[model samples]
Target: MIVPPPLRFGVLGLGRAGVSMLPALRTHPHAVVAAAADLNPTARAQFTRDFEVPAYDSAEALCASPEVGVVYIATPHQFHAEHCLLAAANGKHIVVEKPLALTLADCDTIIDAVERAGVTLIVGHTASYNPTVGAARAIIRTGELGRLRLINFAAYTPFLYRPRRPEELDSASGGGILFNQTPHQVDASRLLGGGMLKSVRATAGVWDPGRRTEGACAALLQFDDGAAASLVYSGYDHFDSLEFRVSTEDERSLSLTSHGATRRALNEGARSPDEETAMLSAMGYGGPAMRSVGPGGMGMFQVELGLAIVSCERGDLRLVADGLIIYDDEGRRSLPLRYDRGVPGRGNVFDELRSAVVDGIRPIHDARWGKATLEACLAIQQSSKEDREVYLSHQVTVGD
Candidate 1:
């Protein structure tokens, strides 16, 4: 009997995202969950028992396991840099959840380790793999929108009801809405921009001063091709206001937004029936406007995982090389654009993490691109804090 090689995976942090992704990882053709680690002993035990896999007390121990070929770092934003470095040092391919690292210096650390070890590192900005996002890219590529002029996107959340621990809310722990939630939008903007960032100008504020982290931020980005994007984000707002939108050179636009009773009432109260008066102020639409909206969490995960599996099997090299090309009639160049309806209650990221390992192809969330995104995040934070525009360097710096 011949024995098959298994791409054994070591998972660190069995949190919500990690737990959710386990199913997909297990389904992968060449991957198997061999070892796991988490700070939470109960979580570690539960995960290991559930999967019938070996469990380690720490990521270090899990990384040291010979059975593990890849390491999935699903820890909080603050720990991503350190986790990636440790995994790389152990010669394991890595898939880290987004934001890469909290700072440029941290990103440099992860980058250096990966390069020095010659290991693959992928950032888990799963939004980049969504089919709707893909569709948007495709549309832009077709020039149906007729030249990219301005892109406007927003992500809003009501943090009042979240279950995060006090430490998790610290800015240093990557607790801000910008650091914790902005990576998806950042990835979207970069994908749409299709070139390196030229400059970034941003203004953000923490509404409750007590929070000290950002409550709202609006950023302006200029890509090398003169394509511009205006990204707005808020963490202090109500849950009903989430939205994402894009506008084109031809005056057409696409929008997506969530709906709620308050939002609907606001819209209804905008006009006065008896006096034919504008009952609400233009700026008082409460916040940013959106076109389409619905529940979007779980569905996003499933799509993301599926793409990772596909990208891994086919090799991410081709996708990376061809990521930016979309042509139009008259032989003009254009970017890709896609629009998709949101789905609810689907399995996600963990699933893809598992499957990618099984396929023997490198995971979609590799180290190099992850390092780049982390570097971008760091640059954004620096620009925001220093009140000056920051530019992404052509050559990325990493730590070993």
Candidate 2:
């Protein structure tokens, strides 16, 4: 038996996503964040103080660091492509955030760069990475559920009301739930419901004139294998779907109940956008929210995404915070999924990256897969804009 040396990682853009990814990074036995880059001196200072590693203001500098074997891209949605190209150019393995890129061409460009550079690229941490979802997929693959028939996902949160950085409220700029959040629900559907999407009919609602973005959206996804997924998302924060968490409603979930608090803090607490942005930053790693960890040191990522149910021929799987609820001919059984907050024990985007870089395994969430997910999301928006059903021609099956 042989042991692989710990893989050191460099982080780009230490925002909420980057900071929040720390716990999951620590979960892997051979993975460690060795350095980071951020424009915010405050974030960099705090990161260096907490991790005791050199933090750089320039992303290139971090990528150039010899100590970093991999790059964890936690930057905003718009910067994903550029940063990925940079990391690939530096010959560093990459873990990029979801939605791959804003457009298919950008996604292709990124794909080309990484392939040419011969560096591994994994995009993820979506609901598809959820342990319960993994459990459901495993059961579905067993053919005990007959076949995947349908998927229903609903997400409602304070996403819109949260502090904005101008682009965060604009869809054209890759803001809103369309670009930022749909990848999770859509990818989950693709993962569990069979990945060959055929078409989608949808509508988007920008009810808040102040926000001027798609605060709400609903889409019906038709799959090639007769499976379908009905997805609805609302960021207005009026109602939270996490309330429907399966089994137990642990009161510890601030994400489940933070609608009012977010509104109050945004409207009354902050005097301007700068202040609100600062407030949001303060919730990232090394900030005030850093102190709040779950039973297994799960950070803010511990929040239950939403209520997701996958209907099969003989049974249905309900995804929850604790695990999954499986109802079949044998009656209902509760499957408690424990990944220790995305530790390396179970399969996920993190471990997938590790396996791809350390070993010779291909990640499920590769660039093409990400492009397929993005295709579905774009089809959803186009379907809404055209007021008709939009068909997807670029979708691929799980292994394809």
Candidate 3:
């Protein structure tokens, strides 16, 4: 078998998310980080020092480089479409971070550019790549779930409390939890429900006056097929659902050990709770030196976070640290999954892109699918603002 040369990647943005993706891009079997772009001199210097790759102070320089075959855009939410267009214009394939764009119109603009350039585009909807998420989608398709009925997903994090660039605290700039975090939940819901979204009714809260973006959101979605989903998310730094689970002994042990120490330290006034959380949030930024135990004992890789539950007709599926948990009339069972540490979820985004470029296989979550998810997210905001249900066109489908 002949092994083709790795696809050379030009990374745009050096923020926390961009920096985090560097290690994976470098380690991917079919991808390599050939160049990077960021406006921050500190970031450029650090990236060059760490990766020994040419770092540019502007995205245009990186995109124009002959070494880059693919451009990975991890810029802030407001700039996604702009960066994508630049990359497409340069005749480069693209891998964009999720929430594809701030609005459906921007998504369409990006779609137009990529289609015109005849370049492959893939959105980094990492949750959709999770093996457990894939397993849930598979179970639903098997008809064992007997027609997907409801999905209940909830997440709470110290998002708002995290260190931020000014844009991150402004909703219009795509800084809030809705644009930043809810994409995962919305994509996961769409994947499991397997239908077009019909409507959404939601409520959002902005508890902190200084941070004007929404601190919490609750939404109810109705699918065309009669399936429904409810989402509850908070970024107010109050609680972490992943750390609060009680089903497994491992969770309990972690809670008693790691969490217990933090609580004790907080009570002792060694550091304020807010300070400790900010420190924790800072860890997610910076270059990618952090590593964690991967699934199925797959060694170490960057850590990702989220929690979700899919309630179908006959059973309930939950994503756990190791894999999945299903509860039904027959009780409960745990399913362990293998991890591909090179990329998010199952690490198939690069492979999918490669297939699209090399074998003409359209990606499962192509631009249309990403646009639909973005539409759903935008509808959530509209529903909250109008205090009424917002209807959707369901413009994108599974295979279109």
Candidate 4:
């Protein structure tokens, strides 16, 4: 067998997402972390020390580096477009973290840049790579479910209570559950609903005095085929749905007893940054770690924290950690899946991205698709503010 040359990656952020992605990139057969860039001196130093890769202070410098062939943009929501443009200009294939951009216009800007540069653009929406999600998509494609009807996704997390930078608490700058969490649900819905978003109606809440952004959101999405989706999310740092389901890959269950003990510790007094990190780590919430590998292999990390159910005319599909559970007139069945490194169906996000870049095959979650997902997410906020259903036709351009 012939082995292809690895795609060299220059990571643009060393933040939480960036750090978590490192293990997957390292384990990927056709990818390598060549270098990294971050504004924080400490993060830069740590990345360089750990990965033994050169580090830069600016994204522009990293993108311009000859050693880097693919630029991974894990920067904040606001910087996504700018970083993507920078990487495109440098002639690098791009992989951007989710919520592709804070707004539709920004997403377009990145899209235009990538199209102009003639490079591949892949959005890193990890939930889309979940084995269960993949199995659901496969089952839907088989037409076993008949006509897709509704997608209901719900998540609850102690998001804000976790470590955060200041901008993470601001809504305008793209902080909050809407921008951070809803993108996963929306992207999954769009993928299974056949990718044409029609409209959205949503409501958001700011129940916490300490956090300025929306801590919770509920949205209704309408697809062009008459399919509808319901999305409910909360990040107030209280109840965790993943804990409730005991579906985390780490095998750590978040029972009420543990939740109350942790909550009591936090309520006792304000925690320093170190204390917070320690607490989060103890709860099995930290950087990525490898799970499974070959056929039936799992990725290094799992961030999904709730449940997603897709209701079809002939059956109902529920997403679980290992795979999916389906219910129909014949009763219930479970389909298990695994990650097979670089192979298409058996692989994870990195594999899909690798195929897109190396083989010139456009992934379903490419830049344009990511932009559509972003539009749906923004509409959720707009609908909540305007007190009306927001139509998506005007949000997406004709060419896109």
The top-ranked prediction according to TM-score is 2
- How much does candidate 1 score in TM-score? 0.67
Give the Cα RMSD of candidate 2: 2.6
lDDT of 2 by residue, 1-400 (tens): 8888877889897777776577667666667879999988887898899889999999899999999989989888888999999999999998888879899999999989999999998887676876777788899999988988888888877788877787888899988888878788888889887688999999988998877989888889999888899998888878876566533445554455555666776788678768777777777666674443223543122232476788999988877666778998899988876665344212266677878888888778888889999999999899999999998987877782
Clashes of each: 32, 0, 0, 2
Q: Candidate 2's C-alpha lDDT?
A: 0.80
Best by lDDT: 2
Measured against the true structure, the TM-scores of the candidates, in listed sequence, are 0.67, 0.93, 0.86, 0.86
Q: Compared with the true structure, what per-residue lDDT tens digits does model 4 show for residues 1-400?
A: 7777988989888766775677667767878889999877766776778888899999989999999999988888888999999999999988889988887788888889999999988888447666677677778889977988999888877766654556777888888888888888887777777778899999999887866788899999998889999988887656666653454534553346544343456555435545554443332212232122333233222344376788999999887656677899999987765555543222366677778877766677778888888888889999999999999963332121
Range of the 10 consecutive residues with the lowest summed lDDT in candidate 3: 296-305
Write out the backbone clash pairs for model 3. Answer: none
Spell out the clash pairs found in candidate 2.
none
lDDT of 3 by residue, 1-400 (tens): 8877888988898766675576667667888889899876766877788778899988899889999999988877788899999999999999999978888888889999999999999998456666677778888888886778888877776667655566776888887878877787788788777748899999989898867898789999899989998888887765666563445664555543332343344345424446543443343324343333223332211122245678887888877756678898899998767656464463566777888887798887878889988888889989999999999984466663
For model 4 the local lDDT of residue 227 reads 90
**Which lDDT value does model 3 have at 48?**
84
The alpha-carbon RMSD values of the candidates against the true structure, listed in the order shown, are 12.2, 2.6, 4.4, 4.4
